[model samples]
Target chain A: MVTYPGLPGPIICDYLSREASRGRYGPGVEFQIGKIEMVANTGTYLDSPFHRYAGGKDLSALPLDSLANLDTVVIRIGGGSVRAIPRAAFQDVPVQGRAVLVHTGWDAHWRTERYLSGNPFLTADAAEYLVSQDVRLVGIDSVNIDDIDDPARPVHSTLLGADVPIVEHMCRLNLLPDRDVRFFAVPAKVAGFGTWPVRAFGVVST
Target chain B: MVTYPGLPGPIICDYLSREASRGRYGPGVEFQIGKIEMVANTGTYLDSPFHRYAGGKDLSALPLDSLANLDTVVIRIGGGSVRAIPRAAFQDVPVQGRAVLVHTGWDAHWRTERYLSGNPFLTADAAEYLVSQDVRLVGIDSVNIDDIDDPARPVHSTLLGADVPIVEHMCRLNLLPDRDVRFFAVPAKVAGFGTWPVRAFGVVST
Candidate 1:
């Protein structure tokens, strides 16, 4: 449970321990039911429109196609020190109606002190570029898609404003190629809940 | 959030409310980061082997193939009055190597007083039958997949003992056909946790 530095990490506990369940089940049959308490932004999580706007769609309102089984495009930001990703990087690729994954390789710093400061983030101009291209969803391997120093979080506002879902804190972007990838990061379909963690994965079809 | 009876429902609050975020972000730009606290067996949740066996695989150890893009086989329990789903209902279906979703029409009682008792469940023999056939996963559109009166809970024991995951409290099974459906109900990749909610859906291939 990799929560942001200021927020609380996930607390996982056993509601019905296997040892305690022996009284409920047979001698050889026992089950352990767990309980979790955490903020929705912990670890790899997706944001629906409702995260940014009150009148926007929540997790239950999102259609399945918007979150699953779509052609993907990965944008690589090399040099390892580029903190502010600009719009120039997204100039001319077939990004319309695709899931764009920004591979910053910043995930190497996950759970470390290095991840807390001067992390890579997408600029507002880049977000404007993506919304202009009608991207279905945008994801990143970094902790927050927006620059924490900037108060507005323009990337999240711009993307979620156009009904484009965002997935943050993704891992294994290097495992994905530049093309022919299909990404999935569906949140639990709970009404009034706008953000939650997901088991984000991508499949490359050769 | 549809938690089981006698348990608390999900509490969804804002960790970062849109009203509060105005101080952080610019005017007209605000984000709402939600927080949730609930038992792992809430609505449409999946159980890993660790839910039943302490040494068994938890959510982090589950391979994606076990939860995604699985060829599905829906076994319809018609007549709307069958309380106990037997192995005979699963016979004559191409269930091997596929996700088996048992439709007992019990979801119609969801969120109602009727959903608490006398609901549908799979017999222990039915669980053994599917495990013998090497079923990849088993799901039910019911609150509990085992007879609550039966203290042993043999179905959960047998199926989870064989490393076959289970999905419960699923809805909308009546909308699915008998075959050519691909079911996906992936849990969050969390270590030390054995159960969690999922946005379960099916893609019917034409």
Candidate 2:
């Protein structure tokens, strides 16, 4: 039950005051850790099928195997003139049963206004292609996996509906190699609570 | 930026609606993939110094290296008995520069009311002892790392003030060998947000 020592984003502060407060539960001093708030969509997080489909599994129902222990491939799409990511971007990559990381270099714009505009996103065809590959997960070093301006949001619907967990708001993808890195991005195990924030990370071979 | 697959939990129904509305710019729809509204203390979360100390490093101030790629060790506390987790519970365990995980059997009670009952926790002296060891992190498989019933909350104060991370409400610790498990439990990268929820996990030798 130990955690890494580090700083948290704004969402956590909101959570500590809202959900983690021990105001009720017991004596004013006895903090039983209150009911957590904050949408599952905050910060570096994972999106499950429940995030899209009406009948999809929630965070607590998701299996652990899907969240841990899988081979990973990072596609370094840094320094690109392209605005929209095309289907061909992942054509040559081996994505089956593996975690696919799209390094759009947009993480540098995190917490900034630019990170939201014209950021890199997977084309709908790419989403369908990834589903076909049986890829375990899809992550991006950008704001959202889908284009924010698009009303349809087909990319998110397609991937999440297929039971593929989405990891967004990720930085430091540049620190990982193209292959052999095992990716992990697991959410909390709250019953009936879908789409909360997560502390996603990867493990490179020693 | 790929992710692992997961089973939908009980709260998937509400999760879908909550996540989809956030959009991408403010908060994406697929971030926290689960369905329950958990406290920040639920499911292997980090406790920063701010959780106890009035003027300690919040989640955002801690270093990334401190939470990732840590050298870890495990101290076995059988059956989660309070007497089992004594000041001497960590004796002879190399503490300096190591993440220590105390294996208590309470994880088996996850999702049940018993998981939050009069569970085992470290005595204040035990907390001071670990601090003396200069351990990097401390974790346990129980409700709270310290007895919430206590007014002072010394265990939390001692470790968090020293910048050691504490992971609480963890499960499946029995799956890990006493040693050789690389533990990782990172929080959101939120500045001034100290107590966000996390998906704490470990990598076992394949």
Candidate 3:
């Protein structure tokens, strides 16, 4: 659902035949192979420490505890008056060792021009607070965690520099409850790479 | 770890600066954006039902019960003499409502020329047995689940056609015990797509 204004959309091309065709491989075997060409930041993606620091851990080195089956807390910011999320927003929530997901309701505008303009973002103080709280991961249902117009990207610097992974361009946060949920956002264990797209989701206990 | 003899490898490119560089964005902002391009079958991947059947469920429609946090069992086939796995292999193992992972020790040759030649595969009877057992998912540590020379792809046809997902080209099964493990192999929820790469893993209860 991501539509970065200037970035290339995901490209899916067929390599093998889907229908029965006369080919060198044979006719009865209708295998469909697909080639995907897209930016790692194309869709809902996770950013490892290497995404910001050259010497930091990449996606492959990320520990499973930090990416899988984590306690989660969802914060609703869509109905709030402020766009710049502050430390006060998380003051009452237990964030330590949890995936703190900020539901901004911006994903409703995904794939539209409005999604690219003036989306909600975390303030530097909020990022610094989360880092100090030892949060395992942070996710937002918005285009970027930091303001796109801000050149410094203080949020990315503070969080990623502290080895906390970030998940952006997420959707369906509303489908999850406020607490007692397990979150997962595991990325491909690709070596020498910083950021990669992920299948991010929250597992609600039935 | 997947080397599709003639297919292109993953491409990782920089979209932003890693260090302080004099660019249009700014010098102080040290961000590294990455662009990835590869075939969906580039590495360890999951196959949805649509991969084999046009009218089947795609990646987006796959239920989480079939992909995440299911009880798992690993079967070691490396010590066996036959490359074609038989139904007798699972006679003593409990496979219903579980992820049946076959460990062939072939991943030792990953990224090598020998990894692609004459790999082990499941026989048609084994596939039928798994389907009848109502296994949640199947994973293999070899190049493919079906013999590459077989044009009909009976294993894939039998499994995927029955809505049984398959994970291929996996590694590190040796790190997991034979049982008491939870397996996950989730693909991106892309609509209309049949298959995609995944970050497959097994979770052990400590």
Best by TM-score: 1
Candidate 1's error at B168, in angstroms? 0.7
User: Candidate 3, residues B1-206: lDDT per residue as tens digits?
Assistant: 34666667788777555643336354566656677777667789899988777788888899988999989999988663457889998868999878899998888878998788687899989999999999989999888898866767889989998899999899988998999998889888877778888888887888
Off by over 4 Å in 1: none
Error of 1 at B42 (Å): 0.5
lDDT of 1 by residue, B92-187 (tens): 999988899999888888888888888899999999999999999999988789987788888888888999999999998988998999889999
Better of 2 and 3 by lDDT: 3
Cα-based lDDT for every prediction: 0.88, 0.69, 0.84
User: What docking grade applies to model 1?
Assistant: high
Query: Order of all candidates by TM-score, from best down to worst?
Result: 1, 3, 2
Provide the DockQ value for model 1: 0.82
Q: Write down the TM-score for model 3.
A: 0.94
lDDT value for model 2: 0.69
TM-scores for every predicted model: 0.96, 0.77, 0.94
lDDT (Cα, tens digit) per residue for candidate 1, span A1-206: 45576778988888778888788777788788888889888889899999889999999999999999978999999977999999988887788879899999988999898887787999999999999998999999887899877777899889999999999888889998899998889998888878888999886776
Each candidate structure's count of clashing pairs: 0, 45, 0
